[model samples]
Target: MNVYISADMEGISGVVHGAQTEPGAREYDRACALMLGEVNAAVEGALAAGAARVVVNDSHWNMRNLRIEELHPAAELISGSPKPFSMVQGLDASFDAALFVGYHAMSGTSPASIDHTYTDAIHHVWLNGREVGEIGINAAFAGFHGVPVALVTGDQMATAEARALLGEVATVQVKEAYSRSAARCLPVAEARRLVREGARAALAQRRGPLRFDAPYALKVEFVNTGQAEMAALMPGSERLDHRVVQYSHTSYVEVYRAWRVFYNLAGAA
Candidate 1:
């Protein structure tokens, strides 16, 4: 079996503050090291479970957090920005299963470490009528390509969000959040062990993908009217109110792409 992994930074084992996730901050290096450790653990686990190929995507801000040299040699890395599929970039129908590592909860989720969906400008996102965060959006994208999200690793809130959205999937909680920027973290070694075990179990189960119905409706509520106005400029997007923009398509992939456009435009505001 082939496996795909999308790695984010916020819910990384040692990450508790925004500074740690930013490129120039003093703590960023340590954060990246911790992130790499968990990713390597997942890769090792997937390979042990008889996966022939493993693809790792750097699915965080700037999309260049993981160093190829530091990664496990058996896995290929996808790193950069403006990827066509963003977080789930390089993913397609060819893979057997996908994993989300170091994910966080949705925006406005209390006690979720560094919670935010896609971007700070996006306050909330809804597919059809159900609210979702990064886990839901990316998992649905994987489902669109006929791949199940088997494993997710992060803080308590992130794992809970994943289970709630994609039932019974394997999860590893590396920390327990006390606030958006505070958590009771697990030691790096312990967290990596849990992640490795989670990956192995997840691939073994081979859960079904989480798919949504066609004629998908996407609604994005921005943090302000200016962001909403900018998002509404996209073709096929309608202004639902002062802070919400709505877009719909029969294909979920199209809606996903439009979501990227919406946030990029909103960020300009």
Candidate 2:
């Protein structure tokens, strides 16, 4: 079986501040090591379970955080940003399953370390009026391509949030959030075990890709009216209110493409 792992850094163990995720800093370096270690652990588990191939996408800021030289010899890394699919780039229906590693809660989630959907600049994001976090957005994208999110790992809040959206999947909590910049983390040894075990179990029951039906109607609410007004300028998009704009498309792929355009336009001005 082939598997894809979309790895983000915010929810990695011991990560609690901007300094920890940013590219330059002692904490950032250490955090990258932690993130890579967990990713390797997941890959190891998948290999042990008979997976023929595994790919790791560095979905964090700038998307180039993982150290390629240190990556598991058997795994390939997808790095960089501004690609057509962003976090979920290179993913398609070919893979047997997908995994979200080091993910966190949605924007405005209380006690989730550095919580935010796609960006802190936005306040909320919705698909058919239901609020969602990164997991929801990325899951929707994966589901569109016929990939089930078999395993997810992050902090307590992130795991809980994923469960709410993806009930049947396996989730592992590497840490417990105390606030946006603080958390009660599991020790390195224990965190690795949970992730590996979860991955192994999740693959055993893989029925099929986690699919989400859509003609996806998306509503993105910004933190300020100015951003909303800017987003509304996208042709055919409607201003739902002072802070939100709505759009509809025939497929999740189309909606995702529009989401990228909408957010870029909103932030441009």
Candidate 3:
């Protein structure tokens, strides 16, 4: 089996504050180490379960948190920032399964640590009128590639939210949120054990490849109207409210590209 692991930092064990996930802070170094450890555990577990290949994408803030040399020898790593697919970079219609490790919740989710979707500038994202977050969007990407999201590990809220969006996938809660910036985390070792177990179990039940719903419709609400107006210029995007723009596509790739345009509007402003 070919497995793809998208790893984020905020929900990693021991990450409890903004500084922990922010670059250049002393806390960030420790957090990165923890994130790396959890990722290694996931990769190791996949290998133990007869995975033919494993790729780990460091899908955090700057996307360069993982130490390449320190990564597992059996796994390939994709790490960088400003990529076209952002968190879902390197994804395509080839993998058998995907795993999201150390993820958080959507923006405004109560008790979630370091919660935000894509960028803090955007307030919410909806697909076919249903609310979603990084988990949902990435799962859509995985689905587009004809791969099932086999497992996800993160904070309790993120796990719950992901389960709600991608029915029956395995999930591991590494922490319980106290707020957007804080959480009550499991010990790093315990969290890694759970991730390993979840990964093994999820892959055991992996069915046929999954695909995102086609003719996708997406709506995005920004923190400001300027962002929405900027996004509304995309061919099929329409202004739906003071801060929301909705777009429809005949394919998941189109919707993914449209979402990229919407996310970039704020940067252009």
lDDT by candidate, in order shown: 0.93, 0.86, 0.86
Tens-place lDDT per residue, model 3, 16-64, is 7878888899888898999999999999889878899999999988999
Between the candidate structures 1 and 2, which one is better when assessed by TM-score?
A: 1
Residue-by-residue lDDT tens digits, candidate 2, 123-158: 999998778888998998888888899988998888
Off by over 4 Å in 3: 207-212
Better of 1 and 3 by lDDT: 1
lDDT (Cα) of model 1? 0.93
TM-score of 3: 0.95
> TM-scores of all models?
0.99, 0.95, 0.95
Model 1 stretches astray by more than 4 angstroms:
none
Tens digit of lDDT per residue, candidate 1, span 31-145? 8999999999999999989999999999988999999999999999999998989999989999999999999999989889999998899899999898999999999999989
- Backbone-clash count (model 3): 2
Candidate 2 achieves a global lDDT of 0.86
- Superposed by TM-score, candidate 2 places the C-alpha of residue 50 at a distance from the truth, in angstroms, of 1.2
Q: Pairing residues by index, what is the TM-score of model 1?
A: 0.99
